[model samples]
Target chain A: MAGKPGRKFQLNEKQLGYAMVAPALVLILLVVIWPIMLSGWNSLFDYRLNDPTKSERIMTESLNLEEYADNRYLVEQGVNELSEAYPEGEETFNETWTVVQNHHEELVAEDAMASSYQEVNSMLNDYEPITDDNLRIQSIDGSWGSDFEAAMDEQIEAVTAVQQQADGDTAVEIGYLAAQLENLQGSVLSSNFVGLQNYADYLLDGRTWTALTNTTFFTIVSVGAELIIGLGVALLINRTFKGRGIVRASVLVPWAIPTAVAAMMWSYLFDGQSGVVAHYMAAVGLISDPGALLTTASGSMFSIIFADVWKTTPYMALLLLAGLQTIPNTQYEAAEVDGAGRVQKFFFVTLPLLKSAILVALLFRTLDAFRVFDLIYVLTGGGPANATESISVFAYKALFEQQNFGAGSALSVIVFVCVAIISFIFVKLLGSDLFPERAKK
Target chain B: MLKNQAGIRFYIFLAIFVFLVMFPFIWIFLTSLKPQNELTSFAWFTSNATLESYASAITTRPLFRYMLNSFVVSGLTTVLSLLIASFTAYAVTRLPIRGKTLILGLVLASSMFPPIAILSPIFNFVTDTGLRNSYIGLVIPYITISLPLAIWILATFFQKIPWELEESAKLDGATPFQTYRQIILPLATPGIFTTAILVFVAAWNEYLFALAINTADAWRTIPVGISFYQSEYTVPWGDISAATVIVTIPIVILVLIFQRRIVSGLTSGSVKE
Candidate 1:
């Protein structure tokens, strides 16, 4: 399939190498690196999806033209009716109407978007939804927007005072007008930008601290257990035996299962009422009762760690088995010649030689355990008072359930920082173990 | 005599380990096969086991559809990431590429980034681009996420290939691309195949992106679909277990068949040859 390349037209090897590698690097930058940077930037603001005022990443005071136009129309109609119905408060109605009309003109002039106002108003009249964000929202001067709000509040207060002096339908009409005036004031949208405030708030938040603690505890305990058990299993599987292939394949079964499915499987086994594992645990007196396994906080933490260990120890064993196989038999023979006991041989020969593999495996497992979401999510759902909530789950709830993007982004950055720190420590500990030639230089 | 005793102890220990590892699946299989009325009882075996749960699981939700979606997403991710990673692995291993160490380190570092950290921005971007429930949306991130490991495994495999063959090909007036396409690719097929299975398993099991990006019921992958099996009141353990068994059987079979290749691929970079 290769066409003949002209000698003068061909790219050099170095350029070709870069050309081949560029697509992957670009994809990583686009999908991974760029998104992380975007999350970091988003963490600086007070953004939310549920709150209309704080929804957009606004830097300046603005006016929501849709709300403004809708409320302005109601106020105009109510004020017209109020003046006609309440002859005694005609002067007050005219004064309030003038103040409202003047403020609307000032807001339009200050924002320099009279066209947007006209468009939104006509759309409202035609009963068409204002879907275009730019046409429905516009920036205005900060101080002027606040002053207009205060003026509207004062007018509403004056109208309320006059309405109190009237009776029956006349007072009812003025009250409705005053309420519309209040809504009109709410259309002045202020900026939601709060630099580092979300991070600051999370730093002070108890739930955030709890989430961090749960994540760290989960990572440490689970990875530690996996290391010990996985090493043992690795040594067992590494030995020469019949059907070793079958054993190795069976070991991968727990790992090969999708994590979400594993969580579901474990949840059934740990089910409070009907779970066999729970029933057996209670029978053996490892837990107080069969139902307590998932219902209690400590039990949940224990259950999750247990399931994680089960699911991932196989992976850890596989990695360590690879490392164990790398050790030549001569080293053990040398140990034997030195009259070393079994324990001494393991501590001296095996553990020493398997350090790199252990580090690599630990690095993968610890990072994985730290970022755990699906297992905890499907099994416990960070439930029973949110005691089992990992930072990832907490972040998921904030981003998706609460629709608080800014707070969620902050939590995401925290997770990134923790992962970075963990990786840095592991790499430092692994120093040159991973790349010996580069380290030698 | 002492050696024989130690061997006996090792076998016993191995048996226990295998039992502990496989018990969860066995228990789930039993649960799936039990009739719905017997699900609440903690029986090791049922008197009347049936395929009722499997029937219910299939009817209650589009389990086959979810499987198909997972296959499409994971399959595309595997093929695309393998193609991209092989080129990268080839470049870093065979060519006189500058910054090879830095490139390898970057690849390793990319894998270390927490997937949650990038979730929000990617979700927003996907939603903004109107690709929230599309295959390409999920496949793109899956490829990016799987690339690092695929590259690492493929690089290790590429390094093990003899350099003399490439030199000989160069002497025979074959261009580098031609040699890579005609010779290197054919030889690296086993490594590529192993990486494909690993990446496919990973993509199939991935939950977060699938949960976030493909919330549409028609586009749900197996993991997300299984997670949504719960109704408003009752938790249907029977149906869930049945679905779990159906989805997990193929993966277990693949892992069993390719045990040696998968192990070698996993351990390749962890140790020096």
Candidate 2:
């Protein structure tokens, strides 16, 4: 159609069109691109929330190592001056800083140990061993400032237990070494360039790679299974029947509910202690333990895949239903006229006509599956030795729990790149003409 | 004739399909209606029924507050998106826009970047704007995700409607806005309704940003509120079932009343012949 407008009115079709889509365009820019540009800029700098100095410049809050060093030095100098005057308690007073650092390091290490992947790890990740006896974990919440003494008191109970286990001033050396090691650990961060280094770190880090593998496997298997099940259900639903609408609606109900609610519901359904599915599995000799589904890789994958498939199949079915409706009954009838059997007709006619719809549905679901996070996060917290940890979950931990946004962004960028490449490959491989009719009209 | 057998086979298969699809929902409701003891211990449909679980779930939080929050947010998002998406779709498809294909491609490619990748930036945006936990923060960023699909659908809808309608309106001395409001809009009603319902459902069920942004349980949606019931010590499966059952029923009813409408909405009126 030519853009020739038979318009005597003030504004023509083109002007009106521009005016119409303007609001949506403005929002798309204000929200999506604006934030992404800002995030990219922020990633270039060393952004730390606890750093008061660089916080003003970056417009995002972050802690400064220099500021922290300065503050620590002032406190140490004050203590030294007091020690030189008092002369009696210098040793004990000087041990306080090391003791506090020791406790924080121990706590962080213990958490890391608990979450680290057991199998499927490279030997490069193994580090110098630190004994549990000397190590002391502080259970204080995420803070490291004026409440340092309060935090020290929080870890005091653990320290008390340690004192009972160990004797004398030797505890001081143990604490000092722990603190020294923690400082050494912090120094490695000095090499951070705020670009692809962290991304490289993620690829190099054994934990991240393991999470990546786990995530890929989860995505492929879950999406694959959902498609088969969804297509089968869609084919069945495409026929006329009593209460057919109700059935279609119910299938969508799972998809309609929030993922959080669905995740928790499935988790309960798979709970070993009193879960219905777990009980059946155990009874059938499918599982040795009641909640073994949550405990192992294969089991957790199955539970999560089941939830994903159950929730998402309706979406696939809905699209496939759309595809099925587009297929002319005459195609099947024409095949039958040629003496094609029902099975042969279905394979030749239905499948070919449904190709575009199948591709579209698969593309949407596959992309969504790759980014699976909240479902797995809520169900198992990517746990039981990191068996269920997706890259998103790993990145979330790096950003939030570990307070390492550099590593987090790096992983996110990798995820973006990988998803983009995969999507491009899918679109190309699925036939450029897959949705030709839709694209044409 | 073979036609009769084919018809019978279709119905038979359809019945089996419906059973499988309906089973989980029936189980959820039946489980919700059952007492906590039976829900954990007994077979799904056979248990003696009770209304206490639903009552407990409702009573546990400011259920009214959650419903209100959901309504206000979803409602606002629906209205705003309809306005934006309809106009955008109209402009690109009906109006003359330069590089329309490029813009559509950009928006479509957005699905490639999962919300997780964009979250940090969006987080910064929300925080910088001081919109953290605000309804606008959640809704605005959400429009980014939902709008692309809505716009695509609406554009397709715009196309299906004959251009003569707009042209005729223009010949009557109607301004562009007048032409759209008086002529083309009424014809696009079904498409608009589809867009509204889809956006509402999406905003209603959104969890990540809703949870991440909003802290207070009183401000939370049904999904986030249900998650808090899970503690290290106790998980109330009964209440969770009850809550899900409550949230699902209204949408299900909407589906029943508007299944064709929904299907049309989904296909962007593609099946109309």
lDDT against the true structure, per candidate, is 0.87, 0.67
B76-159: candidate 1 lDDT, tens digit per residue:
999899989999999888887778888878888889888889998888888877899989889977865799989988888888
Instruction: Tell me the spans in candidate 2 whose CA falls farther than 4 Å from its real position.
Output: A1-9, A44-46, A50-193, A429-441, B1-16, B36-39, B45-49, B269-273
Q: Over 4 Å off in model 1, which ranges?
A: A1-8, A64-138, A151-187, A436-441, B1-6
TM for every model, in the order presented, reads 0.89, 0.77
Give per-residue CA lDDT, model 1, range A1-441, as digits (tens).
232466645556677789889988888888888999999988888899888778777778888888888888898888788778888888888898899888777766744588788778888989997767777778886487888888998899999999899999888888998899888888887888889999999999999999999999999999999999888877766766777887888888888778999998899899988799999999999999999989999999999999999999888988888888788888988889999998998899999999988998898889999999999999999987999999999999999999999889999999999999999999999987866233133
> Candidate 2 chain A, which ten residues in sequence have the lowest lDDT sum?
A130-139
On DockQ, the candidate that comes out on top is: 1
Worst 10 residues of 1 chain A by lDDT: A432-441
Query: What's the i-RMS of each model?
Result: 2.6, 3.2
Candidate 1 CAPRI level: medium
Distance from true location, Cα of B46 in model 2, Å: 7.1
**Which pairs in model 1 have colliding backbones?**
none
